[model samples]
Target: PAPTAAPPEFLLNAPGTWNLPMRTALASLPRSVWLLGLVSFFNDTAGELIYPILPLYLASVLMAGPRVLGLIEGIAEATGSLLKLASGIGADRMRRSKPWIVAGYAVAGLSRPLLALAASWPVVLVLRFADRIGKGLRSAPRDALLGASVPAHQRGLAYGLHRACDNAGSVVGPLLAAALLARQTPLDQIFWWASVGSVLAVLLTLLIKEEPAPPRPSAPRPDWRPGALPPAFRRYLVVLGVFTLGNASNMFLLLKAKDAGMADYQIPLLWAVVSLVAAVFAAPLSALSDRVGRRRLISLGWAVYALFYLLLGLAGEGWMMWALFGFYGLFMAATEGAEKALVADLLPREQLGTGFGWFHLVSGLSLLPASLLFGSLWEAWSPLAAFGSSAALALLALVLLRRWVGLPAQDGR
Candidate 1:
């Protein structure tokens, strides 16, 4: 007997009809996203604990100054950018993401303990490089895994929830470090504790189930050259690259907070506030992109960032710094997840790893110069000059992006 298709009324009315089964299925979809979010939460908690303190450690403890900071960061980020591109291709060739993900975490986890033992600036430099290498290796594959695990309709939500969880960890990590520091815990001890959290993050990666590859209709052909992506994707990457050139390391932002009369202790608290705001808004704003459009949200986020940079440059008091930092979180919430979701929409499933790799590579590679430029401007001129210039570039990028790419409509899910 021939199988009967579903009735036209059932198919057509699916969105309007409040079916319990459909609702349950929709509810279940965000699960994998949330789980991955938990993993990111733990991982970022570990990262933030040390990341916020590293510059102080270098400047005061190791007697290194802004020059060393710029050199180390530039080298580490450049290495990471290249590795991100390579790891993407490797992940696609190996057809396994978990190993790369696990290895990356393990490497970073082990390096944190070494940071505890560093007695000199060079040692710290070496350890930072290792940590960033792990980051470079894992980032693309992990993102690819996350994208593959969820339905296309929910990519924004998935990436947003992940970013939110990651930022939530960022919020908690600094708070924990602050408490520990207040209790007179040694910096070395803090690094050791962060190492424990990193280990736990690596363990969690073991629990994520990779989706099986779809069976090929014929034997897979070897294609050493992965072709170019869609024109929209290429254009989007260019705009992102431009934006990243102005988006230097957050270390500069911390330095600005200090310069703006924030006490040493207050810096961490300000960062915590930023993280909390980002965590709270990330998921909702990302989900909003699904209904409206990613380009609009991303462009708005960039504009907000320009405003924050200007505010940071001009801020004179602690309260003003805090306000700008809080607003900075909103910028991240609007942009980060929506950017990735847009990439997923533009690229084919098989090319995801490469696409993400290139996306990250272009963005990450810009960081080295951006950081150097910001640091040099701060040293040679005023903090206001440095930040104002960055703000101007961001505003320019925003204008160009809007002109070059109109707001994209939601992809038909």
Candidate 2:
């Protein structure tokens, strides 16, 4: 185990937290973290190819509507959320996450081809549910494993690079999808290629070498269960959960662009740019978080989100819509890895999986209602109502965060 600054309360023989390593290059990263980043790159590339186009697919191919899109995304996200918690509990008991990690990549990869055969919304839902089952199984364990590999002080960079690679693939996948769509390639053929990235992700995941897990504590486990997370993490969750209440699925962003007069094929290109911006900024912002503060970076991202969403609600120009898409990407770049690193900072090494699981659960479950509400509002009221309400909620979340969430000054470790 890496050296520690201090152990947490009530855990003897437990490893102390790790210190910052001298980070110099890609070579400075732990081999496992780098490999995992590659795995996320391919896996997310596969996912983004389908995801950016999926709303269009449902609308054009299956004759589904906006509510259908919202329902599918909400259900799929909820499935991942609940399973994340269950898989965390299981991973804690088993003490090795590699098998779950491998299985997740494999299942998600293998399921992509099945989507090609779907004839209706329900079929897509079933396949998506299966795919998210894989995502749920892998997410918490993968995060815990990644968090375990790096020092707490440097975690932002490690996970930031991972998200960068992940969104980098998102950039490539959508551009590729756009190019293919421009040439009039069939959607079914695109789904076939999706499996390639995921398969490579599975193979790459096999290359990562995990440290042997520390033994579980022998004393009777806390009766509060996941409630046993440190006080800081618990408090942070309140703000995180509320913010997620407005973090509707990204599909809505595309739906908004479409409403703003963008063509179906153009959506992929827009998404490619959004992802390109996210990929460009992810590493830099995350590295900055290590220097300044994670909470501040995250709050700034939400502030940007609030501004963008407010503009989205009232904007009249296509160019502004495009600009908002890029800003949306910037928001993701700012928050994605910083939030996970913040969670790691707040918890002990042993409970990292459970901590991430709870984060995923709360965030995703909140998304279900948020999406449902957004879609309902869009249908019953106007796009303005939906986007305006979202902007308001995001602002509310930022206020709550300032009131409740605490960030101690960094030690320059």
Candidate that scores best on lDDT: 2
Q: How well is each residue in 210-326 modelled by candidate 1, as lDDT tens digits?
A: 776675556454232435566777777788878888888888788777767766666677889889988888876776676666777788999999999998888878778777888
Model 1 root mean square deviation, Cα atoms:
5.1
Model 2 residue 342 CA deviation (Å) reads 0.7
Native-vs-model 2 lDDT?
0.81
Q: Candidate 2 has which clashing residue pairs, if any? A: none
TM-score for every candidate vs. truth? 0.90, 0.92
The segments of candidate 1 whose C-alpha lies over 4 angstroms from its true place after superposition are 1-26, 217-227, 406-413
How far is 56's C-alpha from truth in model 2 (Å)? Answer: 0.9
List where candidate 2 sits over 4 angstroms from the true fold. Answer: 1-25, 221-224, 408-413
**Candidate of highest TM-score:** 2
Question: lDDT tens string, model 2, 304-324?
Answer: 998888888887666677788
